[model samples]
Target: MAEEEKSIFFPDDSHKLWSFGDTRTYQRLSSNSSGFLRQLFIVNIVFWAAFLIYFVLTASQPFAVQPLLLAVLLLPSIFLSLYVLVALRSAERKRLKLRASGFIIYAPLSQDVFNEHCIDFDQVRSLRLALHKRHFLPEEECLIIERRDGRSLVIPFEEVLTDIRRSDFMARLSAYRPGLLDLSEAPALPGEGGPSFTELWLHDFATQGTRESLGLLPAGGSLKEGSYTVDGIIGGGGQGNAYLAEGPNGTVVLKEYVLPVYRGTRLFEDLSARFFAEAKLLSALDHRAIVKLLDHFVEDSRGYLVLEFVEGPSLKELVEKEGAQPLSTVISVGKDLSAALLYLHGRFPAVVHRDLSPDNVILREDGSACIVDFNVARELERDSRTAVVGKQAYMPPEQFRGKPCPQSDLYALGATLYFLAVGQDPPPLTNLSPFEDAAEARSKDPGFAEFDEIVRGLTRLNLEKRIRSADLVYEKLSRLALKRRES
Candidate 1:
């Protein structure tokens, strides 16, 4: 089409180009439009079959059908079905145009043209490319547009045509405004000029593979109707289990909660509600020091959470295998855990990790640490009736009484550092004075004196005497780290 004919507004409103300024336009149909047409056709056929059968069965003479009654029933059905097909066809051909300022979504055929279809670039918050999983069928790739107001639009890719157009659109969008979109969860294009539609599809196909080994559910069997393929079991408790699974994007840890209560009972409903609500809050957190909650759902009366798989060993396992780490390593790991706690406590509604211990902290190959297992974490609401939960060796006095605050995490952090230094779990439910425990090591290295002092303050029996917050702990650790490096 000529540049003069291209529309700055709706592509269907072509005449406006002549009166107003003209700009470039791109168009594509919504991929889901065909699915709607197919469903409508099926419903039309089923209704006709049912109506004919009922009329024949009720008739006085089986062979003699009244033409007037038949016409009354059949004509409207035929006309309405035709009208619906036409409307769906129109929607299938409707255009979505991308321009310099923003993009335009054509209104559905049944909706008014003035409906909210035009969206500016500024309104867009993120663009995530993810696969939409389907049962016993190929997963469909889609673009999820998250708006600033928490609304989102999911548009599935339309095979080759849509993929090609998307690559071009993304390129032009970047040229128009560099770094305007957050594509952290999106895959990279093949080359500097971007990949062809075929190349991109092929790359996606390679990553989404069928598991070759047996798991909790056989090699190919899945949970949540094939959304997640269980590869192996990672951990399990009496009430639940965790599986290493393959998700659409990549590897994930699928945590299961077996809610054994009867579905109709009030207890079952409350448990399900609380499980999903916490999942939502966990998903909102975006930080490297914490595990990310990717997706969540319930099936067969059991709740499941899809989490990012952090590839590393837990601090407990690392310490057990490697023995006591050096003072420098202890300080480094402490800082990472402290920063994670600071972030958790710093949220608008502060979060308390009721159970923080070496067992839940992972040490990655890159040498950074991240906190995991938020099953016992909760937003701080100062509820006196809060459940008492945590490892006995790491729990503070207040936490043991079911009153955990942000400072409780600090106490646990101190115990974790002691484990890293002493290579064994600290004595349960006691104020740790690690100086005596590490006295022999302190005699070898004077720095252990300072490290032990920090741990002592953090594990003080009285709340008033204990290290108050993650912020203060981080500052002290930072100075200790600097002093070690200078020496």
Candidate 2:
């Protein structure tokens, strides 16, 4: 006595049968009443009647020939009709069994039992609804079961007059597979049919609304088992949003991948992997001049990186508020940045900050500089699939073509320094040397003379002539700082 399993029936006759047991749930769908089947039957009748009329009008042979012709023409229709009947009957007989172990789809053919499909619970990734419509069929809903390894199975439902059946189905599904259909925290669903990357990117920025309205979790939302509470959204870009958060330890910054819509695409997968790797790399490095990664986690299909909260405005903000800084402060900040870059590049497999711009550098209250936002950093062993990503003004020519190296970072660093010195963005790189501009800057401010040589060496148009390593730049800046102190 299984305690007389509870049964819920759809009053609208949308679902053929549904039974729930303590250990399992069962569902059977009717296809005969489907809009698709009825339309198909009507179409077949129309075609058959038309053919009969045409044969009666055009027949020149005996009446016996007409029967043969009709039979020949109608064979395919008969076979199709039989297929539809059998399919509908089979669907009505099919039982979807849900157990703690997994899902089993079973039906009987003749005297033998047929298990059409069985899926292990571990392989199940998510379950969602898909709207499918065909020639004669009205728009119908199908339950789509998505697997972790990127496979899917679609189960069509019977035509129900109300949505109550769908609601019941979802409720039962959630009860059986609690988190499977909860895709809010799952990574983006993978598939190919969506808006283009460029279109999505444009839409993300062009649209204006609050963080929650734009699909971002609002401030005060708890994350990582209540370990971190979001303070507010600090910044965002094409890939993700950065939030200032507070935790038990102290204040931290959380960078979360916000593009849930791109989850199943190759681009989403690639970027997600890179984001995790970046978190790992940042966590391993120990430098005061570099933002420290505290932890990383995946929530609601979105990846997040927890970083140490730097308590200061970004260099870009500082400059915008208070024009150019003192030469000594500029030189000190440059030297600190160079040291951070040296540590990154000195690794066995050098890390290149592909998107080094003034905005990426933060100025502390004590006048020290720390490099933040390594979203586009990559190892020296570059992959062919790496896309060119960075600010146009800061990116070197080689970087624009997807070939970034230590020299490319150097060019950006020089450009950043130039902006700091002149209180404005540098002109686009052409045949004109940045040194010529630096020379004019030196005439206005003598401290620029000290950095003119360094800036020129670092921002050379030709890669062959540019300063080769961050270490070398650091060393040169260190000497200049020492010289300035001595004088």
Candidate 3:
């Protein structure tokens, strides 16, 4: 027999019926209760008594009440009260479903009140709890959800209370988006009702105590309607910025591409289209040595790419801390990078990583290298527009002229290796000769000469003299590493 799905139901007497299941859970709110029925009965009696008194005072005949007249007057009042009770009960029959990605508020009778009933975690801007009380009735509490598009959803809090002793309904809501609900209270006059604590929390959370900001997004701010929360910037360049963020999939690097062109212009549209197309292509790639592209989007007239976060330090940081790397370490990194490039270049029509540098290579904790930063990458095509992109020191002559080919990446790789083998950057736009600068490597490894030859060939000024492909580069590095191991 198939095992029954495990679920926990709230206590029988609770106004809310909460059921927790494996894949789906829901909180059902109903207004029908014995207490409400008793209240209604009492109200009907009082209403009829008031009507009888009014009729007697206004009657022309003294000490006499007509049964037919009384029946006609009280009938409408009874029907009106029943209609009101039905409407109120219908309005309270709401269901809150907790989905994997977000939550849904289902109010079949009160659907017209909200712009949207389903809300993703990213769509939420801020949440607030407010209490409203009138002259003689019990206080009513509501949860107000403010969205990014200036719309709001007000959910009654009374029926949402579950019988769970450990956690309440609001606590469950908070679990959906950690740190989302601001526990702080918003200052307000005793009777004011329009504004709540959400506005104050949002204002402080976005500003971070600074009136003026220098970056495109604040540290605690979110993007894509709150899907990704920015922790802080990881890196930035002339064209874009990269941020380390917390997302549904855990830590991710958010790369923002800033297009200076005005929105709605031909240039802007063209740029945006190309960016998305390239992003789509990149997202299809799966390689252990390459940082995976998780997602991409455009918001506020800027393009953003979500990439898997590499756990280890960049090659640049490694070198900065340890000075020049050992010959074996350099060879391992070279082979890994070459393999990654081969995978990219082997794609149909070819994908050229126009930017490759020590700063773009991250060494994993397991010592394998992962190539990152595809902001300037493109599919190989001779007729494509030339955009001067990449660091000057690592960029070759062709790349500086905005005409990078697959070999342009080889040159940058050579420069990166040169920085690792020797403790400094090679001169830009010049052929590299490692004899004078690689004494430290030579002292450490006897096979440094062969490695230097590979670097020299890769950084050659003439295209004909440069190393041909990532395959060839990988072969050469493998041989050098093998020889070192044998020796």
Candidate 4:
């Protein structure tokens, strides 16, 4: 941890971002909360009501209450009230800067954020805190600050009260004015020229979004033999868990779609068909780097797809556990990846793995890359095409306008390589969330000029301007690998 700090930096953390809590056991209230939000509820109601009445009575236009104006005022007030009442309820994330030790990082979300980028957290006076009055309330409170920035980060103190370890965190923070030493292991590297790693983490300390209250996991009961036995859970996304399961005589991976009833049946069926269709399409093709589809089934009124289960860690896991891998791992993985794409694209009706991120690719025990989660939207009926099946960030711009093709897959591939080269996820295309992860990653480690150049060629926002094909990516990567080997 200390070694990584030397090579990293963090932006000022004066401003705070979102917060959450775990219900320890999935109850309506997350366990990390302190119920401070409930207290804030009474306080906010009384304060807002008092001021709102006074303002309405004296205002020239009265309580204009337009959605737009009301929205603007309520937004900050909500954040403020949450900070005021729910002390340490929410965890504050620096949108721009981070504070170092002894000193507070002063990166502001709205103004002069760049100034706080390089400042050391050690030099700052205090850090921010997310406070809440209750476990269920969405509002938060702001308590700690090097000085006074008018905002606090989120921290679930109420629910944490019951957790001995979490309660210890509170006790530790109490000793230091700003709070306990920040505890994030992620490099403080804030993308751009921000505070050094040590400085940024100086104020890093937070609680889990939810507090686990004694009992959360289901009783460890063995079930009678069933059709399938779940193996290792590989990963999860908007879809569901990707588990290695065994059925009949062979091993396979199954992806189940768990969703809220509100998503509508149309969306679920559409996703299921698309998944099956993609598997079927992939099944028809044989590629060294691609996982094969053995069979698919639907029973018990549930949706699930089965495919070959390749063993080994994912590219993302490798990076997190062991920084950047040798170019050999990169090239070997890249070669298999490109070969599979080449085969898929050459098909009479080309296939596209629209969401090609590290999480979707696995490093097999045989030293090859196996692609997963290729979307088969084309296989679906026209009615289901608009349901949105791919991971937005890895998708090309064309996808945003409702287009999926081979080129779209290449966009994902390019993004995948960029992530490999930089050790970070790319920016997302979906609007449901924000903050481009790819851009932030690149800023963190530009690497060599050639490497940076490669990332640029692959991840261009403009499809036309981006590297044209799988073959081209392979060719460039081959040359890059050869050059690195010689050097």
Candidate 5:
């Protein structure tokens, strides 16, 4: 038989037997093989009949077969014929039916009770094809359906459907559920062939495998004269992704700035320049409570910053896992962060961390805090017409009017502290009176009373009335810390 004869059977215009009500059936038929099975059955029957006749004629002779020998010969031929017949019957009954709602597979030879398996489209998350290479024939294809809950169903196409019919089925499936047909193979990990298209699609494009594919430069790959190798994406935001990378000194956090929308635009160039400037400022900054920038480089039109990788959860994560912190712990964290901010303010250019919240502050294992995510931080002497940025709930009143001084960062710290004490985010600035909120927070826990005056000083609505500098805030928190220790 021709190779094409074994492929899936598709009905033509003249052959209208496939449809039954609203369902369409497809089958692989041995009937198309030019009477091969029928011929074999006839030949076997004739040979067996002749042998039985000869045996009967010679039954009385001494050379004739014994009863036991005759029984053995007859049983073997009968069993072989039955086996072939069963196979022919099974081939005739096997089929796949497709309906508007779902698909049904029928296999009479299998142990299934009803000899059928039905599947609904809604259970499918993705559909992919696997190819099996053959030495002397076309590659065999199998369809894999991955469900949303992680179960997978494999449907083999071998001797089941024709090439044309399989193509039609795939086309229909794609039309019914676009983006479900995944043509790409399973992706390799980093340092293997890098990530494949399937990995990029399945992952959120923030893992180690998909960095380069997402256009954020590759992790585990070298950068900056082979001094740093990105490991994986630690976190991500609207601006870019931050990666845990390895450097000559030790592990560092690599921040890559790649804005898809700003590519090829003047805004991209401006932001890139600002990113470099920030890197330089961070490299110069050396403080125990601040993430240190070790090195920086620009590659493939993307800016990269190598920063100190703090090995601890952010304050946000800690608060979420362990609810409200002890007042003493909160005071210590505040004191450490305030000192870090004072260092920034005391710089010659006076850097201001425009966006400082619980998420940006890492709580080290030793209970100390480190400030991170300086992507939006700006130098006081540069760019007066910068756009407003920072979390709205934490922004000072002047920040809403596009003027953020050192006091603005102090307000954010107050809001962050309030969250730590109250186990909830403070109400928006418009609806909130910082002093009243602080007093109410203190009322909840007597421990918060010592920090109420500090919170009020930091979060005062008027810029002039707010904490004058990070230095003063640090001094106040230090005194509170000292008092707690004495007790």
Candidate 6:
């Protein structure tokens, strides 16, 4: 093969790369090896028959007493069968173990290894999904990649090797790092990478000689199949139980709703509309400060969401712990929350977060705010909704009359700040009853002076009089914080 001829035959595009996965290798496992094993079993049965026949002949009258050659051959065959049986039992255990660790991608339809650059195992960091998952757990099913430098990169494995070829990854691995795997024997396609920590644990757990055992299933579950385990109970809404789950791959928020409860909702039509709509709203927004949706699934006959778990507390909790946050803190939170709303309101169908309370606002470790909980939120497609969405205390006067707008959210932010500083809901809203008529009633109470002005601005019975925008609120809050510091 001349170099020129080889170059002409294999041009650059002679083969292209595919990462999202192309189906070139997916096929049923061949039955030839199984047929061979069956034949071997038949051979063993025949040898056992021969041994019995020789014994019977010797026992019969006038039969030859000794058949030494038959004994010599029969003994070896018996021993060989025993050895093979032991080897097979061990192989089954390993197969089951590998299946438990992660999704066993049964070699995509196109299972050719694209080995343009041979990987060095020692240089590999954790392999991860390029695109964060929307409906499926990406962390569990992603490609195992290696990086020589701090920069991460995934190798296009499918186009280079055949999945069923079994020794392809092992051969490639050993060529780079001899004796990479613990066993003297090389690994199959899925197990080609030197035994990972997860793989090792799976092996130990899977092969353990015990009374009961478990196997891998989907991250999300259906009534027929249960899902992965839940590790933490994070938050719960009226719809379902929200939990932090130990995903087969990574950290996920498991939203488990009782089956019978879901089928019996009065808001069935509206709930279904909002349920999928929430997922859609989350998928559309890609801003950094906003919470990201990693994946979601309906499992164990219930629904769950895999969210990027931010390690911090919510603004409500912050206010609770500190009694009241400085005005500066409120402004910073308001800015982020408002920006998110602006994005939501401008979206195609227009997302309206009906519940805009502090409890739903999470404060990141870096002191940034993120608004969450769109469970009760409604969408107005082309603008038309007679109904309203918001807590009574935070709702503007127009809302009580069954009308709300973007200004309603700003009013809520004001009420939240007043509550944080004054340690009470607005006096007017709280005292909508006959006895406590208005601010005059609240002003008479001890410790009322400190919050009188703040409460007045928030408790404006008229929506027209409430804080109109987050921009205005941000500026006022910054000024208050500055004044407080100087005094």
Give the runs in model 6 whose Cα sits over 4 Å from its true position: 1-228, 248-250, 257-268, 381-383, 386-388, 428-460, 474-487
What is the TM-score of candidate 1? 0.55
Residue 100 alpha-carbon offset, candidate 6, angstroms: 39
What are the clash counts of all predictions, listed in order? 0, 8, 1, 88, 3, 20
lDDT agreement with native, every candidate:
0.69, 0.66, 0.69, 0.51, 0.64, 0.48
Candidate 4 Cα lDDT to native: 0.51
What is the C-alpha lDDT profile of model 2 across 229-290, one tens digit per residue? Answer: 98898888787788999988999999877534432333543564466457657867899999
Model 4 regions lying over 4 Å from their true place: 1-227, 231-241, 248-250, 257-268, 375-389, 427-448
Residue-wise C-alpha lDDT for candidate 6, range 21-104, written one tens digit per residue: 211111223212343346467769987787678777776653564568567777799678767654443222111001101112
How far does residue 291 in candidate 3 sit from its true spot (Å)?
1.4
In terms of TM-score, which candidate is stronger, 1 or 6?
A: 1
lDDT by residue (tens digit), candidate 1, 221-282: 58767889888888987657788999999999988765533322334334543454457568
- Give residue 43's lDDT in candidate 3 (0 to 100): 61
Note the residue pairs that clash in candidate 1.
none
| Model 1 segments more than 4 A misplaced | 1-216, 266-270
Q: Could you tell me the lDDT of residue 133 within candidate 2?
A: 55
Per-residue CA lDDT of candidate 5, range 1-487, in tens? 0111111222221122244432333333323443434645775788678887887787787365677876778768766776765565454434555433345555432221113445566666777767744334455565666777787755555433522244335433432344567777633234555433223221221111213444555656777678888888777877777888888989888887763332223354355445645765676789999888776655444557778889898988998999877787788889888888899888876888988998889999999999987777977843244568888878887788777777888898888887787666776573233335545555655545567778877888987778889999988888887776776
